[model samples]
Target: MRDAEYCFWHSPAHKEEAAEARRLGGQRRRRERVVNAVYELEGMTNVGSVQRLIEIAVQDTLGLENSVARNRVLGTLAQAALRVFEATEFESRLTALESVHERRGKGKR
Candidate 1:
């Protein structure tokens, strides 16, 4: 029997696979849309906001197939999370320093 060539989407043998792919694609699109809307409305204005964004990216990236691109993205997100940690530390140190300076000024007066 001569079998006709058909693409995955049009192949009778691949109907179930194609349907699964379509369902996953729709789910991914909906998730991306919701993430985008939340990001736009919240606008990463603080450490918590920034960390949440990085966390979401990491979670989504983890679902991706293992590849060089996925690894690179995970590396970048890790760096970003580290930076947020550094910023939080710096902010705490700066606040302590300001408090010390204020006490010193009051004592000198």
Candidate 2:
């Protein structure tokens, strides 16, 4: 799943904000690799690949040791992680997503 974003900018201020998202989201293709590596090494069964990676990342990377708190943090990170791998395989799935968004945006001209 490629998490991609397309923003509509009607003003210069919005354009600047969009630029920031674009810049930060650049090279987000690494999410799949990092998450995949974590799951493979940890052998986490219950968590999906994305969630497993997020759990390890919160613990190992963020140094959250408390299990309960770690889970909460991991949940937040899981949401963020969705953005981390944007458009890695974007071109393939993008057309469908774009089509849906396009149809919605252009309804009943």
Candidate 3:
């Protein structure tokens, strides 16, 4: 067995350890999937996703016992929420402008 080319973890002497490692790895992956499903934070393609993330951060930070760290995190979340609001406002305005332009173009034809 000493002359075998198998790696330490793959060797027959460490078969149980290898099996346990594989089992733990699979368990971790399943847990992550469940957490991701619960949070739905995989693909943040829209403002709603960003808002949800900020909301979650704010909620979690509120429970912190350290005031300084809590306030810092809350401040950051506030700024992120403000930025998202601004972007939503801008998007609404741009959409309205595009609608007007489309209507004017139709009238010209």
Candidate 4:
């Protein structure tokens, strides 16, 4: 008798179809990984200081080395970091200038 497992639907002749199914499954798995990475990055915003958040975002973006979306995401994140750094520097300089103004006013009194 023919092997019980070798029914016509499950026969070796259909191996290509089975391989295609496996390939699609792998693509779904990769998509899920990217989604999870996005959620992880979003969660960082709620839980960390700005510096910590930036660090985690950069590190996570770096970890997506082979991802199709990696370069786009990294470029956006880098632009955001530049803005944050510039704002911080501006605030610091403003505070220092205000401190100098206060001292000069005190000297005149």
Candidate 5:
């Protein structure tokens, strides 16, 4: 998943999440992993904070772009995305968030 998509999935609050979750289209565990990541991040920060802590949390907790540590990765991304709102624009962030799910999906170019 792209960095932008990662940001999106983490920040979105409304149907965007539902849509992305639907887009991901997989086992309940995968959906839970993604949503779970976003959920965990919402606590420390809401959105648009973007700071060193956020960066560290994302790369360390979420493993940057690697989902090998799936739960940890999502947790990290969710945290960073919530904070990144301050650093980046709205759509760019959304794209970043969804990118993760997009990559995980079965087919894409």
Candidate 6:
């Protein structure tokens, strides 16, 4: 006899497995959104507005009030910030070195 609660494809024994599959599917979708946001932001000349929007969207979409999801969002933001900071710092140092060399060349002439 077949169980009515589970239909033809799902048996009582597979109930938990079905639930797990649904949960994983949701997680995978959320991750794809995050990855796409990162790629989209990477191509932008300025990411401040877009990044904030994406963060809010991800939080809402992923239920990031939950610590695990929140941590992932925060970690991604931190990495982006670090990369921008390092690049800016390098540019500033390079500019200062060029200025000093230019002043020395002028003095020699």
Off by over 4 Å in 2: 1-10, 27-29, 41-109
Q: Model 4, range 69-103, lDDT digits (tens) per residue?
A: 98888888788788878877898899999999999
- What's the distance in Å from true for residue 39, model 3? 2.4
Q: Give candidate 6's whole-model lDDT.
A: 0.70
Q: lDDT tens digits, residues 3-100, model 3?
A: 88898688988899899999999999999889768987764788998888888888888878878878888988899899999999999999999999
Output the lDDT of residue 104, model 4: 100
Q: The CA-based lDDT of model 4 is what?
A: 0.75
Q: What ranking of all candidate models by TM-score puts the best one first?
A: 3, 1, 4, 6, 2, 5
lDDT (CA) per prediction: 0.89, 0.63, 0.88, 0.75, 0.60, 0.70
Residue range 59-78, candidate 1, lDDT tens digits: 89999999999999999999
Give the better candidate number (1 or 2) by TM-score.
Answer: 1
Candidate 5 structure lDDT: 0.60
* Two-way TM-score contest, 4 vs 6, winner: 4
TM-score of 5: 0.21
lDDT of model 1 at residue 91? 99
Angstrom error at residue 88, model 6: 1.0
Compute the lDDT of residue 81 as modeled in candidate 5: 69
In order of listing, the candidates' clash counts read 0, 0, 0, 0, 15, 0
Give me the overall lDDT of model 3. Answer: 0.88
Q: Model 5 shows how many backbone clashes?
A: 15
Q: TM-score: which candidate is best? A: 3
| Comparing 1 and 2 on lDDT, the stronger one | 1
Rate residue 29 of model 3 by lDDT: 92
- Worst lDDT run of 10 residues, candidate 5, spans 41-50
Candidate with the larger lDDT of 2 and 6: 6
